[model samples]
Target: MMSTATAIQERSLLGLKHLSREDILAILDRASYWEQQSEKLVPILNKKFAVNMFFENSTRTRFSFEMAQKRLGVQVMNFTAAASSVEKGESIYDTVRTLESMGVDAGVVRLKPSGVLQELAQRVRIPLINAGDGNNEHPTQALLDLYTMRKVFGELQGLTVSIIGDIKHSRVARSNLWALQKLGAKVQFCAPSVMSAPELAEHAPYVSMEEALKADVVMMLRVQLERHSGGLFQSSEEYREQYGLTEERAASLLGHTIIMHPAPVNRNVEIDDAVVECDRSYIFRQMAHGVPVRMAVMERAMRD
Candidate 1:
């Protein structure tokens, strides 16, 4: 029989919603192996080719994937909607298919639609990785987040993680919630009624801001104001008082608790500038850990 881990290795990473605990740990274990290597470049995948198709704007995720690919000696191609034939009305499938026809071994994709990635995964022969897909999931980001958390707490079996902010539109929150729970951590959400995802209530409960700060990890999400229409909050200042990680809230967290954010953070909006680089903040560390986690992911994607 093909083992579950073997089965997992053969597929595209669409989301973490269906990933098992063992599968997640295996990837994290691989990430740890990559992190410990002293060599700056490992030519394990010297001749392989991979293309990054991003229909949306991004910085960290895109750059991290590029760095990870180069370290493994993979030939990389970058595609953005604004610069590609996509701007002339080419469909996403056509763009990916075009790239696949050009001899790419795998694809790392980020787009604005929710269900399109799953559909693309089925249509494409090369392994497809979900970088971010609307409000659906950002599996690699969650894996790195899990990697960071494990480094601190040593295990996820009983850790408490509170994800606070624009939950309705956050792929980060969805990805973290699914991955965290599968690894035995308790996950909770704290978003204003307008910002909460009604569909997620069955998986995790929404809590008060005061209650959220008490967790072993307080993950403040980026408040996606561009995704909001109107009547969400009076202004950024108001959101700061109610939902942002203000200095007062940081002071109230338990001594062992750590602060995290999936960055491109609105410094004074979703989190205060002072608390961003404070002792307990792992915001930047998360960025550093991303390279290894994604290196593991890209390596796995190209494996037969």
Candidate 2:
């Protein structure tokens, strides 16, 4: 039999823009299959080795990918920049090439630079999955978000999803905007003037917070304070008043409208604490769906 690592030598998942509508649906279908097989651990990736190389810090994306690998029976190596020679000025290309030389089948990479993942993809021979790349994209998160919505609504067409807050600094928002639009969902952006991006006007029109709340789905983005230099907002209190999903706002939404956040929630800043636990909130459920969606991605990436 061909070695497991060799089977995935030709595949890499860089971004949602690389996938077709049919490709997106097939991955979702695969995720559903994995979800149904939850209780049983299937070892389709037995004897394969994959590495998680996170140049950026993450909790959900990193651990979920690790969990998906373990559940699929793939041996995993975790690489952190601080712990690796990356701290000694080793380039990403050299580091990943070293992993490739070690016979790893695939790599899941999260980097802080926008186009670095694609650059690394070109240099590496094994399959490389982009976990998140700066403000460029987070394809897997978008896929899982879509999968979570599909579980609830059965279809994406005609559903309106309003993404509120920090649009200029969100990889999640960019990925979701592309995927949701391609899947026939109407998307809108709502954010403070400082946080809005000119590019967003091409994909979705900006709407008032009240107008945004009328959508079937409300996705609140955290204030990306780390990525911003300064002056995005004067105060968190003011941001909460204008853009936060307050308890009153959540309560006022239609019964069927749902709430979402790509998490690391800002408590009362981007979304009210109480609103996060409300019946309409599917934030945690979205985290739960990450494993299966990642499983589907890894399985397909490693397939012959």
Candidate 3:
């Protein structure tokens, strides 16, 4: 017997910021179940239609959600802003309303403007999953990240995760911060002063790059140079030298420490090429785990 509040909450994943510890764990547990399945396709969601509306460009998140939907046998409609009426100045809300009118069961969305997803969720009739909403949050990414950590450590309790690089512009950092702390994991940030989020200083301490490497998980975010105004650093090489996970820095990490990055990696910018595929790096594993985690999320969104 699910309460009305619980039913609504489970139907849409706007972000992990509001999810309780039990809610987070339940998603992880379900993801583990999906990963264990030997069947290539479950088809439990056959005939259910989902729309992926990407107002912004994406590689991993877009494809991952599509794969997750397909695995469950949900019919998928992918909408790219560049190819749609959005280019002719249609409001995001109008575009969504048009799709909802077409009888979509769910919408997985990514957009450049912050706080708009909340408005959409309020207005839309169908369930909506936040693929990303500006720099506010990327709920599914954080969920997958948590799943990856849980797989390695067996639990989230007592784990220390340091998220390094571009904190001020990272939705991933914010999502991870809220969700990890709720699950009893320690969350820390390591970023240059210019890239640090002053709003979050009260929540997690910003550590130096050297100190950040000691955590159970060292998650490196993309440098996001396109978002910067002027020169944050003189060059990518300099950013690498200062904040990037160089081979030397990677060597100093604890034996139990694991490296991570939510990629579109910068090659040698935020992390060295040598360390990208190193035994301790979980970047690829993170991408691999995104499938099942999202499958769990899609199932939850459409589940009765």
Choose the strongest candidate by TM-score: 3
Ranking by lDDT: 3, 1, 2
- Tens-digit per-residue lDDT, 250-274, candidate 1: 9989999999999988999989999
Q: What digit string (tens of lDDT, one per residue) describes model 2 on residues 9-122?
A: 435778887678998999999999999994657888988999999999997789999999988989999999979899899999999999999999899999999998877776
Candidate 3, residues 152-231, lDDT tens digits: the string is 99988999999999999999999999999998999999998889999999999999888898999999999967667585
TM-score for every candidate vs. truth?
0.96, 0.95, 0.97
Better of 2 and 3 by lDDT: 3
Predictions: Cα RMSD each = 2.1, 2.6, 1.6
**Each model's C-alpha lDDT?**
0.92, 0.89, 0.92
Q: Return the top candidate by lDDT.
A: 3
Clashing pairs in 3: none
| CA deviation > 4 Å runs, candidate 1 | 1-9
In angstroms, give how far residue 96 of model 1 lies from its true place. Answer: 0.7
Please list all clashing residue pairs in model 2, or write none if there are none: none
